[model samples]
Target: MKKVSKAIINFDDYVERKNTDSRKWSMAGMHEMATYVDDNSIPLWVADMDYKVPTIIIEKLKKRVEHGVFGYSIPSEEYYNSIKYWNKIRNNWEIEKEWIVSTPGVVVGLNFAIKAFTAIGDGIIIQNPVYPPFKSSILNNNRVIVDNSLIDKNGLYFIDFEDLEKKASNPKNKLMIICNPHNPIGKVWTKEDLEKIGEICFRNNVILISDEIHSDLILFGNKFTTIGILNENIINNSIICTSPSKTFNIAGIPVSNIIISNEKLRMEYLNEIIKSGLKPIPSLFGAIAVESCYTLDGLEWLEEVKRNLENNYIYLKDYLKENIPKITCGHLEGTYLAWLDFKKLGYSNQVLNEKLEKEAKLVIDPGEIFGEMGTGFIRLNFACHKKILIETLERLKIVFGK
Candidate 1:
């Protein structure tokens, strides 16, 4: 792919987000326990990017807005074709039209999957520190959360496959949610790692739910292998939750593509959606956004975004090492979220939160919400202009640099 010129996409240009119903910029975006902040506070918490979405998507949406008739809508052939095109070109996976199920968001799809596949009191597995919603979805529906915690070897994280196998072997555990290019900690699972996970799920009668929302945000030469692209048997036994929302920074649009190749599982999932009275139909604008962003034209914008995110990560890592050596950040293999280790600061999670929010005036996702394993850490979203990232780093230095 050819490099995108700055003239085409000026990633460094700072865009104002405050007071625009922006979740990240609002005090409401923070945890209930967090300290209040004034206008000077910088929010690096939310997973959504601070940058504007691609011009191609903006133009497409504008055309639809001009139509001025907002009514009930269904997925178009163009929508399905766009999904197929993206997967084939990006992940090299060919998908059938019938296999695709449109969901409002990945979390919604997860809740429906849990309802469809497992009975009450059945166990659902997830690896943490991970996205917090994975645990909430299970408990909210009266299902069991069987945690297969990841091993933190130094700063880097690794899956505890042995523990996972034991959890899967148990008859009560009926499902497992694996985050590819995992959130909080930006570790992208290798093909071998995925194969092992798939084998465990296939053999144990556990339905695998692979959330690949961050697959397109891979950085620093890491590869993302979609679970659907694995062996035939594994593909039949798994569900892939994906979306262009994360890729193109249109997360507020609420669009996701949940792919299930197995006919029986797909039917069960659809049946659950119907029973719940929640139709999987995309909004007119949602359908247009997906169709617009999932094309070959969106590739240039994506590449440039990845590059900008990588540069931000590099800057954050280096700035910490030089200015505040007590804080350690792991290599960001994928995703724009940088997992920072602040245990060396000798502060409890409360103190850490206070220091960042109260003193530093930097609002970021405290690691504890991600799970117990994430305590003593922070998830900093780096998908912003360099100027914002620099200001964030300088704030950390002011508060934590003793």
Candidate 2:
């Protein structure tokens, strides 16, 4: 692997993604009102980035494709080692090989955790204005949704622990899914926060499922502490879902590693996957992509990506504050997503979304989808080239400044 300097990593270089069946682009379709937008519409909706994948991973994929025999493939020992090494080096968290369970995706692993830990009709607690899938995974598995919605004050988000404790106290509330370096709101939870939540869950007999998928994307010098590292009790009772997809822009390649330190919990989750009729092995390309993404070259690429993301956030925040004062953006501690409060504008979700689509010709994730708390807000993906983000903001000024 070649070492590339930050100066050489061209995050500003635009890569055309239109008509590529991209969920962030062409595939968003009529359901998202994307079909009605013009061809030049700026899409800042999906969690995935508009940037290209790191060159190292792409080269590795090309070589794998050249082999041309895509047969049933199992994860290699190298794959497990790569994950172990990444956890140790990147997160300062030691993880053993046996503790890792390969899943097709984080969302799939979430469903497996829901099945393994909680029974049908059991309550699953989640912090709202969270990733939409957290709610879907619980409901789709016949589990009840118990929302411990975060408290928003002056554009910042904080976990409502009292509400969380009350929700967890319910005997039927068997599980809680935590989004570390939380999506949409982009709050990188602190050690203290994790410990408090862990204690609440431990005492209430609620199994904790920590979705640390965005763990690798800590922005603006914020540190991410995994719930597994909180304490012995937390580690014993928690399952962590991690992936290289979001960090490396390889989300299309399905791969996630579910980490469970407790032997009993690990086996139960594996059994649930087997019962679901889904093989535990990831796809051939998924294995290669994960391994490639944890290498030294990959780390270097990610450093550059993080810097670019930080710059993008700063640029967007300042631009909105100066030009579109009605829109308030919260401090982005992690993730490329920016949570923008539009309540001051006093527009309904329907009208706001329509104005964005028809007037500005832009597509962003409406906050209402995250939960009712997300009403009067919108989440913007600022992980594109700086030029594209500038254009999007200009469009926003045109639409909302009226």
Candidate 3:
């Protein structure tokens, strides 16, 4: 592994994502819309990083690609060991070999667990201004959503325990989805926070689904404690969804490590997966990516990535503060994402988002997409080179300059 300044990482050499029918890039090419801003803007909305994946992962993929054999596949014992090793090394929580059941992705695991644990109309709880997929997973699976809106104070995010407790105790609510080191807002819940959440869920009989996909992406100054490690009660109720995809810039690869410690949840979800009859072939190249990312050179590359995120976040914060004073992002504790609160700008969410897309030539995710509380906000992905970060911020300043 070579140590070099992340600023030297070239993003332009990265191939264009346009032709892949990427939702993050493609405007969907609707000819009927009067104003298609995606046509003009460079997208920073997607969660994927713009940096090149580590050389180790690239080499592993190359070896796999070189192999011409394409047949039904099974994850070897080493594959499962890789997942266990990652949890132990990065999360400080040793995973039982029996704990992990590979899934195609977290979204799929969420749906399966929802159906397996709770029936239709069972109330499911989630903190608001969270990852949009959490809400979608519940509703799309016919489970009711019980919003426990997080409290934001002075740019910091905290769990709304009063509200979460109320919802958790509700008889109709049977499941609560917890985003460990949450997305968009980037709050790495402390062990103390997880303690309260676990007790509340345990007492209320609410099944906890902990999405820890971003756990490994903790920024330089923060710590990410897995919810399952907080307490046995939480672990018993918890169905943890983790993947190398978000951490390794391989969402397109799509291999997820799904863990359910409780035998009941494990059995139920297993039944659902089989009933759904989804094929179980291993994602060969993706498997190689996960293996290399977790078992080899993961810690070293991870440290560099964390440094890159911290430096990028600081650059973004300084730029926005100096140029776009109205845009204030709260403390970003984990993940390379910044959640910008633009309420001071006095523009409707739609107007603000449109301005960014058109005038700024930047495709940012509007807060409204998260929920009503997200109306005055936008989620910015700063997981790119410093130069690109500077360009994105400068473009926004030019568009929103007073």
Instruction: Identify the leading candidate in terms of lDDT.
Output: 1
Candidate 3 versus the native: TM-score?
Answer: 0.93
Predicted candidate 2 versus true structure: per-residue lDDT over 198-251, tens digit per residue:
999999999999999999999888999988677899899999999999998888
Clash count list over all predictions: 0, 0, 0
- Model 3 stretches with alpha carbons more than 4 Å out: 1-22, 27-35, 279-281
Cα-based TM-score, every candidate = 0.97, 0.96, 0.93
Pairs of residues clashing in candidate 2: none
Give the per-residue lDDT digits (tens) of candidate 3, residues 134-168.
88888898889899998878778889899898999
Top TM-score prediction, candidate number: 1
Among all windows of ten consecutive residues in candidate 1, which has the lowest summed lDDT? 1-10
Model 3 is weakest, by summed lDDT over 10 consecutive residues, at 1-10
lDDT winner, 1 or 3: 1
Q: Comparing 1 and 3 by TM-score, which wins? A: 1
List runs of model 1 lying over 4 Å from the truth.
Answer: 1-7
Question: lDDT of each prediction vs. the true structure?
Answer: 0.89, 0.87, 0.80
